[model samples]
Target chain A: MQASEFSRWTEENAVYAVPKTIIRVGQGERSTAIEGAVTEDFLIRTLKDLIEQGR
Target chain B: MSPLSDRDRQTLREMFRDLKYPVHLQLFVEDGNQGSDNAKVLVREVVRVMPDLLRLDVFERSRDSLLAALYGVWEVPTLILCDQKREDSGIRFIGLPSGYEFAALIEALLDVSQNRIRLSEKSLNFIRNVEDDIILDVFVAPT
Candidate 1:
Protein backbone atom coordinates (compact mmCIF):
# COMPACT_ATOMS: atom_id res chain seq x y z
CA MET A 1 0.00 0.00 0.00
CA GLN A 2 2.33 2.77 1.10
CA ALA A 3 5.30 3.45 -1.19
CA SER A 4 7.80 3.07 1.66
CA GLU A 5 6.42 -0.27 2.77
CA PHE A 6 6.40 -1.59 -0.77
CA SER A 7 9.96 -0.44 -1.34
CA ARG A 8 11.15 -2.17 1.83
CA TRP A 9 9.55 -5.45 0.85
CA THR A 10 11.10 -5.36 -2.60
CA GLU A 11 14.54 -4.71 -1.14
CA GLU A 12 14.56 -7.82 1.02
CA ASN A 13 13.05 -10.57 -1.15
CA ALA A 14 14.37 -9.89 -4.62
CA VAL A 15 16.27 -12.94 -5.84
CA TYR A 16 16.81 -13.43 -9.56
CA ALA A 17 16.30 -11.25 -12.55
CA VAL A 18 13.59 -12.59 -14.81
CA PRO A 19 12.26 -10.70 -17.77
CA LYS A 20 8.64 -9.53 -17.63
CA THR A 21 6.43 -7.01 -19.38
CA ILE A 22 3.34 -5.18 -18.18
CA ILE A 23 0.77 -4.28 -20.79
CA ARG A 24 -1.73 -1.55 -19.95
CA VAL A 25 -5.17 -1.65 -21.51
CA GLY A 26 -7.63 1.19 -21.71
CA GLN A 27 -11.14 1.03 -20.33
CA GLY A 28 -14.42 1.45 -22.27
CA GLU A 29 -12.75 0.29 -25.46
CA ARG A 30 -14.62 -1.77 -28.01
CA SER A 31 -11.95 -4.10 -29.37
CA THR A 32 -11.34 -6.05 -26.17
CA ALA A 33 -13.03 -6.86 -22.84
CA ILE A 34 -10.99 -4.72 -20.39
CA GLU A 35 -14.23 -2.89 -19.51
CA GLY A 36 -13.13 -1.42 -16.15
CA ALA A 37 -10.11 -0.52 -14.06
CA VAL A 38 -7.95 -3.01 -12.24
CA THR A 39 -6.82 -2.42 -8.66
CA GLU A 40 -3.19 -2.32 -7.48
CA ASP A 41 -3.70 -4.85 -4.69
CA PHE A 42 -4.96 -7.43 -7.14
CA LEU A 43 -1.99 -7.08 -9.46
CA ILE A 44 0.53 -7.16 -6.62
CA ARG A 45 -0.92 -10.29 -5.07
CA THR A 46 -1.05 -12.04 -8.40
CA LEU A 47 2.54 -11.15 -9.24
CA LYS A 48 3.72 -12.13 -5.78
CA ASP A 49 2.19 -15.59 -6.07
CA LEU A 50 3.59 -16.13 -9.50
CA ILE A 51 7.07 -15.18 -8.34
CA GLU A 52 6.90 -17.14 -5.09
CA GLN A 53 6.06 -20.33 -6.95
CA GLY A 54 9.19 -19.82 -9.00
CA ARG A 55 11.24 -20.35 -5.84
CA MET B 1 -1.27 4.04 -12.58
CA SER B 2 1.47 2.10 -10.82
CA PRO B 3 0.36 -1.52 -11.07
CA LEU B 4 2.64 -2.95 -8.38
CA SER B 5 3.10 -1.76 -4.81
CA ASP B 6 6.61 -1.66 -3.27
CA ARG B 7 6.22 -4.98 -1.49
CA ASP B 8 4.99 -6.69 -4.63
CA ARG B 9 8.03 -5.52 -6.56
CA GLN B 10 10.40 -6.87 -3.93
CA THR B 11 8.66 -10.22 -3.93
CA LEU B 12 8.84 -10.38 -7.71
CA ARG B 13 12.54 -9.57 -7.70
CA GLU B 14 13.15 -12.38 -5.23
CA MET B 15 11.11 -14.85 -7.21
CA PHE B 16 12.88 -13.98 -10.42
CA ARG B 17 16.22 -14.92 -8.91
CA ASP B 18 15.45 -18.58 -9.50
CA LEU B 19 14.15 -18.28 -13.01
CA LYS B 20 15.77 -20.60 -15.56
CA TYR B 21 14.26 -18.87 -18.54
CA PRO B 22 13.88 -15.21 -19.43
CA VAL B 23 10.47 -13.47 -19.26
CA HIS B 24 9.49 -10.88 -21.78
CA LEU B 25 6.32 -8.78 -21.64
CA GLN B 26 5.15 -7.12 -24.83
CA LEU B 27 2.66 -4.32 -24.25
CA PHE B 28 0.31 -3.48 -27.13
CA VAL B 29 -1.14 0.02 -26.95
CA GLU B 30 -3.18 2.32 -29.15
CA ASP B 31 -2.08 5.95 -29.47
CA GLY B 32 -4.45 8.80 -28.67
CA ASN B 33 -6.30 6.73 -26.10
CA GLN B 34 -6.93 7.87 -22.52
CA GLY B 35 -6.04 4.52 -21.01
CA SER B 36 -2.66 4.42 -22.71
CA ASP B 37 -1.16 6.83 -20.19
CA ASN B 38 -2.22 4.73 -17.24
CA ALA B 39 -0.96 1.62 -18.98
CA LYS B 40 2.40 3.28 -19.48
CA VAL B 41 2.63 4.13 -15.81
CA LEU B 42 1.89 0.54 -14.80
CA VAL B 43 4.43 -0.80 -17.26
CA ARG B 44 7.10 1.56 -15.96
CA GLU B 45 6.38 0.64 -12.36
CA VAL B 46 6.69 -3.09 -13.02
CA VAL B 47 9.96 -2.59 -14.81
CA ARG B 48 11.28 -0.45 -12.01
CA VAL B 49 10.79 -3.31 -9.54
CA MET B 50 12.25 -6.20 -11.51
CA PRO B 51 14.46 -4.82 -14.18
CA ASP B 52 16.31 -8.06 -14.75
CA LEU B 53 13.40 -10.47 -14.91
CA LEU B 54 11.00 -8.19 -16.78
CA ARG B 55 11.16 -5.93 -19.79
CA LEU B 56 8.28 -4.08 -21.46
CA ASP B 57 8.07 -3.44 -25.19
CA VAL B 58 5.45 -1.19 -26.65
CA PHE B 59 4.04 -1.73 -30.12
CA GLU B 60 1.91 0.91 -31.77
CA ARG B 61 0.20 -1.07 -34.49
CA SER B 62 -1.44 0.66 -37.37
CA ARG B 63 -5.03 -0.11 -38.22
CA ASP B 64 -3.76 -2.69 -40.68
CA SER B 65 -1.28 -4.20 -38.21
CA LEU B 66 -3.93 -4.39 -35.51
CA LEU B 67 -6.52 -5.73 -37.92
CA ALA B 68 -4.18 -8.12 -39.70
CA ALA B 69 -3.70 -9.81 -36.36
CA LEU B 70 -0.43 -11.56 -35.75
CA TYR B 71 -0.42 -13.17 -32.24
CA GLY B 72 -4.12 -12.45 -31.76
CA VAL B 73 -3.35 -9.38 -29.65
CA TRP B 74 -6.71 -7.62 -29.83
CA GLU B 75 -6.21 -5.75 -26.58
CA VAL B 76 -3.56 -3.45 -25.13
CA PRO B 77 -2.71 -5.33 -21.93
CA THR B 78 -2.21 -8.75 -23.46
CA LEU B 79 0.86 -10.72 -22.24
CA ILE B 80 2.63 -13.43 -24.26
CA LEU B 81 5.33 -15.74 -22.94
CA CYS B 82 8.33 -16.89 -24.99
CA ASP B 83 10.59 -19.75 -24.00
CA GLN B 84 14.40 -19.76 -24.10
CA LYS B 85 14.43 -21.29 -27.56
CA ARG B 86 12.30 -18.46 -28.89
CA GLU B 87 9.17 -20.53 -29.21
CA ASP B 88 5.75 -19.05 -28.51
CA SER B 89 2.97 -20.96 -26.82
CA GLY B 90 0.13 -18.52 -26.82
CA ILE B 91 -1.36 -17.65 -23.39
CA ARG B 92 -3.56 -14.61 -23.55
CA PHE B 93 -5.89 -12.50 -21.43
CA ILE B 94 -8.57 -10.18 -22.84
CA GLY B 95 -8.65 -7.67 -20.02
CA LEU B 96 -6.41 -5.89 -17.54
CA PRO B 97 -5.21 -8.34 -14.90
CA SER B 98 -6.91 -7.29 -11.68
CA GLY B 99 -8.73 -9.24 -8.99
CA TYR B 100 -8.90 -12.89 -10.04
CA GLU B 101 -7.38 -12.10 -13.40
CA PHE B 102 -4.34 -10.63 -11.69
CA ALA B 103 -3.61 -13.97 -10.13
CA ALA B 104 -4.23 -15.57 -13.47
CA LEU B 105 -1.63 -13.33 -15.04
CA ILE B 106 0.97 -14.31 -12.46
CA GLU B 107 0.12 -17.99 -12.88
CA ALA B 108 0.39 -17.63 -16.60
CA LEU B 109 3.77 -15.96 -16.16
CA LEU B 110 4.99 -18.74 -13.89
CA ASP B 111 3.72 -21.33 -16.33
CA VAL B 112 5.47 -19.58 -19.15
CA SER B 113 8.69 -19.01 -17.23
CA GLN B 114 8.84 -22.59 -16.01
CA ASN B 115 7.54 -23.95 -19.29
CA ARG B 116 5.17 -26.05 -17.27
CA ILE B 117 1.46 -25.88 -17.86
CA ARG B 118 -0.99 -27.26 -15.29
CA LEU B 119 -2.50 -29.53 -17.92
CA SER B 120 -2.49 -33.24 -17.37
CA GLU B 121 0.53 -35.24 -18.41
CA LYS B 122 -1.35 -36.37 -21.45
CA SER B 123 -2.06 -32.79 -22.46
CA LEU B 124 1.48 -31.72 -21.68
CA ASN B 125 2.82 -34.51 -23.83
CA PHE B 126 0.47 -33.54 -26.59
CA ILE B 127 1.62 -29.94 -26.45
CA ARG B 128 5.33 -30.70 -26.25
CA ASN B 129 5.56 -32.95 -29.27
CA VAL B 130 3.49 -30.71 -31.51
CA GLU B 131 5.66 -28.76 -33.96
CA ASP B 132 3.24 -26.11 -35.03
CA ASP B 133 2.83 -22.91 -33.06
CA ILE B 134 0.02 -23.23 -30.54
CA ILE B 135 -2.06 -20.12 -29.98
CA LEU B 136 -4.39 -20.09 -26.99
CA ASP B 137 -6.91 -17.32 -26.34
CA VAL B 138 -8.38 -17.08 -22.84
CA PHE B 139 -11.20 -14.64 -22.13
CA VAL B 140 -12.08 -13.62 -18.56
CA ALA B 141 -13.73 -10.88 -16.53
CA PRO B 142 -12.23 -8.97 -13.57
CA THR B 143 -14.41 -10.26 -10.79
Candidate 2:
Protein backbone atom coordinates (compact mmCIF):
# COMPACT_ATOMS: atom_id res chain seq x y z
CA MET A 1 0.00 0.00 0.00
CA GLN A 2 1.12 3.51 -0.71
CA ALA A 3 1.61 5.98 2.10
CA SER A 4 -0.88 8.21 0.33
CA GLU A 5 -3.50 5.48 0.36
CA PHE A 6 -5.61 4.49 3.34
CA SER A 7 -4.64 1.40 5.26
CA ARG A 8 -6.83 -1.65 4.83
CA TRP A 9 -5.75 -3.14 8.12
CA THR A 10 -6.59 0.10 9.92
CA GLU A 11 -10.01 1.22 11.08
CA GLU A 12 -11.40 4.57 12.13
CA ASN A 13 -11.70 3.62 15.80
CA ALA A 14 -9.20 0.79 16.01
CA VAL A 15 -5.76 -0.04 14.65
CA TYR A 16 -4.89 -3.68 14.16
CA ALA A 17 -1.12 -3.72 14.40
CA VAL A 18 -0.48 -7.39 14.18
CA PRO A 19 3.01 -8.68 13.42
CA LYS A 20 3.39 -9.82 9.82
CA THR A 21 5.89 -12.34 8.47
CA ILE A 22 7.10 -13.05 4.97
CA ILE A 23 6.12 -16.36 3.46
CA ARG A 24 9.07 -17.07 1.17
CA VAL A 25 12.66 -16.11 1.87
CA GLY A 26 14.33 -17.29 -1.30
CA GLN A 27 13.43 -19.07 -4.54
CA GLY A 28 12.62 -22.45 -3.09
CA GLU A 29 10.42 -23.06 -0.06
CA ARG A 30 12.87 -24.61 2.37
CA SER A 31 11.92 -23.19 5.73
CA THR A 32 13.81 -23.98 8.91
CA ALA A 33 11.12 -26.24 10.29
CA ILE A 34 12.98 -27.67 13.26
CA GLU A 35 15.19 -24.72 14.18
CA GLY A 36 14.55 -21.00 13.97
CA ALA A 37 15.09 -18.75 10.97
CA VAL A 38 12.18 -16.36 11.18
CA THR A 39 9.90 -18.66 9.20
CA GLU A 40 6.29 -19.79 9.65
CA ASP A 41 7.11 -22.58 12.09
CA PHE A 42 8.97 -20.23 14.36
CA LEU A 43 6.01 -17.86 14.33
CA ILE A 44 3.59 -20.66 15.22
CA ARG A 45 5.78 -21.71 18.11
CA THR A 46 5.84 -18.14 19.31
CA LEU A 47 2.04 -18.01 19.13
CA LYS A 48 1.89 -21.34 20.94
CA ASP A 49 4.00 -19.86 23.70
CA LEU A 50 1.43 -17.13 24.11
CA ILE A 51 -1.37 -19.68 24.24
CA GLU A 52 0.55 -21.80 26.72
CA GLN A 53 1.04 -18.81 28.96
CA GLY A 54 -2.69 -18.19 28.88
CA ARG A 55 -3.39 -21.70 30.13
CA MET B 1 21.89 9.39 1.81
CA SER B 2 18.77 11.53 1.78
CA PRO B 3 15.96 9.07 1.22
CA LEU B 4 13.06 11.46 0.64
CA SER B 5 12.68 13.92 -2.15
CA ASP B 6 11.43 17.46 -1.62
CA ARG B 7 8.10 16.60 -3.27
CA ASP B 8 7.70 13.53 -1.10
CA ARG B 9 8.49 15.57 1.99
CA GLN B 10 5.91 18.16 1.08
CA THR B 11 3.26 15.54 0.49
CA LEU B 12 4.08 13.90 3.80
CA ARG B 13 3.93 17.19 5.68
CA GLU B 14 0.37 17.65 4.49
CA MET B 15 -0.51 14.10 5.42
CA PHE B 16 0.96 14.58 8.88
CA ARG B 17 -1.27 17.54 9.58
CA ASP B 18 -4.01 15.01 10.29
CA LEU B 19 -2.10 13.48 13.17
CA LYS B 20 -4.09 13.98 16.33
CA TYR B 21 -1.25 13.16 18.71
CA PRO B 22 2.50 12.91 18.71
CA VAL B 23 4.06 9.68 17.60
CA HIS B 24 7.61 8.86 18.61
CA LEU B 25 9.85 6.95 16.26
CA GLN B 26 12.29 5.00 18.39
CA LEU B 27 15.01 3.59 16.16
CA PHE B 28 17.44 0.91 17.35
CA VAL B 29 20.47 1.05 15.08
CA GLU B 30 23.65 -0.97 14.77
CA ASP B 31 26.89 0.91 14.10
CA GLY B 32 28.45 -1.00 11.25
CA ASN B 33 25.58 -2.49 9.27
CA GLN B 34 24.76 -1.11 5.84
CA GLY B 35 20.99 -1.61 6.08
CA SER B 36 20.89 0.01 9.49
CA ASP B 37 22.77 3.00 8.16
CA ASN B 38 20.31 3.44 5.33
CA ALA B 39 17.30 2.99 7.60
CA LYS B 40 18.63 5.66 9.95
CA VAL B 41 18.69 8.14 7.13
CA LEU B 42 15.23 7.15 5.96
CA VAL B 43 13.77 7.47 9.44
CA ARG B 44 15.35 10.89 9.94
CA GLU B 45 13.88 12.17 6.72
CA VAL B 46 10.39 10.95 7.59
CA VAL B 47 10.57 12.38 11.09
CA ARG B 48 11.52 15.73 9.62
CA VAL B 49 8.24 15.87 7.74
CA MET B 50 6.27 15.99 10.99
CA PRO B 51 8.37 17.46 13.74
CA ASP B 52 5.35 18.48 15.77
CA LEU B 53 3.71 15.10 15.62
CA LEU B 54 6.75 12.84 15.47
CA ARG B 55 10.12 12.65 17.20
CA LEU B 56 13.10 10.51 16.29
CA ASP B 57 15.25 8.70 18.84
CA VAL B 58 18.12 6.49 17.79
CA PHE B 59 19.76 4.04 20.20
CA GLU B 60 22.81 1.80 19.99
CA ARG B 61 22.96 -1.46 21.91
CA SER B 62 26.61 -0.93 22.77
CA ARG B 63 25.57 1.89 25.04
CA ASP B 64 21.83 1.19 25.47
CA SER B 65 21.32 -2.53 25.28
CA LEU B 66 18.88 -2.43 28.16
CA LEU B 67 16.43 -0.27 26.26
CA ALA B 68 16.63 -2.50 23.23
CA ALA B 69 16.21 -5.63 25.32
CA LEU B 70 13.24 -4.10 27.05
CA TYR B 71 11.63 -3.75 23.63
CA GLY B 72 12.63 -7.34 22.70
CA VAL B 73 14.75 -5.97 19.92
CA TRP B 74 17.72 -8.13 18.95
CA GLU B 75 18.17 -6.92 15.41
CA VAL B 76 19.68 -3.86 13.86
CA PRO B 77 17.48 -1.25 12.18
CA THR B 78 14.45 -2.05 14.27
CA LEU B 79 12.04 0.85 13.93
CA ILE B 80 9.49 0.94 16.72
CA LEU B 81 6.43 3.17 16.58
CA CYS B 82 5.74 4.62 20.00
CA ASP B 83 2.88 6.65 21.36
CA GLN B 84 3.09 10.12 22.88
CA LYS B 85 4.70 8.87 26.09
CA ARG B 86 7.11 6.71 24.06
CA GLU B 87 5.33 3.49 25.02
CA ASP B 88 5.81 0.56 22.69
CA SER B 89 2.60 -0.09 20.75
CA GLY B 90 3.80 -3.52 19.68
CA ILE B 91 3.99 -2.14 16.15
CA ARG B 92 7.48 -2.42 14.71
CA PHE B 93 9.35 -2.66 11.46
CA ILE B 94 12.29 -5.02 11.91
CA GLY B 95 14.26 -3.82 8.89
CA LEU B 96 14.74 -0.76 6.77
CA PRO B 97 11.22 0.29 5.86
CA SER B 98 12.13 1.20 2.34
CA GLY B 99 9.94 0.62 -0.73
CA TYR B 100 6.58 -0.92 0.18
CA GLU B 101 7.41 -1.00 3.85
CA PHE B 102 7.54 2.78 3.85
CA ALA B 103 3.78 2.87 3.53
CA ALA B 104 3.52 0.56 6.51
CA LEU B 105 5.76 2.88 8.50
CA ILE B 106 3.69 5.93 7.60
CA GLU B 107 0.47 4.15 8.48
CA ALA B 108 2.06 2.95 11.68
CA LEU B 109 2.90 6.52 12.60
CA LEU B 110 -0.75 7.40 12.26
CA ASP B 111 -1.83 4.31 14.15
CA VAL B 112 0.60 4.92 17.00
CA SER B 113 -0.50 8.50 17.36
CA GLN B 114 -3.92 7.20 18.31
CA ASN B 115 -2.44 4.62 20.69
CA ARG B 116 -5.43 2.34 20.35
CA ILE B 117 -6.25 -1.15 19.22
CA ARG B 118 -9.73 -2.16 18.15
CA LEU B 119 -10.51 -5.73 19.08
CA SER B 120 -13.58 -7.90 18.93
CA GLU B 121 -15.79 -7.68 22.01
CA LYS B 122 -14.80 -11.15 22.98
CA SER B 123 -11.09 -10.40 22.70
CA LEU B 124 -11.38 -7.01 24.32
CA ASN B 125 -13.27 -8.50 27.22
CA PHE B 126 -10.63 -11.16 27.60
CA ILE B 127 -7.79 -8.67 27.59
CA ARG B 128 -9.58 -6.15 29.77
CA ASN B 129 -10.14 -8.73 32.51
CA VAL B 130 -7.16 -11.01 31.98
CA GLU B 131 -3.73 -10.10 33.31
CA ASP B 132 -0.79 -11.25 31.29
CA ASP B 133 2.07 -9.67 29.40
CA ILE B 134 1.73 -10.17 25.67
CA ILE B 135 4.65 -10.38 23.28
CA LEU B 136 4.16 -10.33 19.50
CA ASP B 137 6.92 -10.45 16.96
CA VAL B 138 5.98 -9.52 13.40
CA PHE B 139 8.42 -10.32 10.64
CA VAL B 140 8.57 -8.65 7.20
CA ALA B 141 11.06 -8.08 4.43
CA PRO B 142 11.85 -5.39 1.87
CA THR B 143 12.13 -6.16 -1.80
Candidate maximizing lDDT: 2
Off by over 4 Å in 2: A1-55, B129-143
RMSD of each: 15.5, 11.0
> What residue pairs clash in candidate 2, if any at all?
none
- Give the DockQ (C-alpha) for candidate 1: 0.02
Per-residue C-alpha lDDT of model 2 across residues B93-132, encoded as one tens digit per residue: 8777988988878877877787656555655565565344
Best by TM-score: 2
Worst 10 residues of 2 chain B by lDDT: B134-143
- Tell me the tens digit of each residue's lDDT in model 1 across B6-26: 788888677666665666766
Model 2, residue B111: displacement in angstroms?
Answer: 0.8
TM-score of chain A of each: 0.33, 0.33
Interface RMSD of 2: 11.8
Best by DockQ: 2
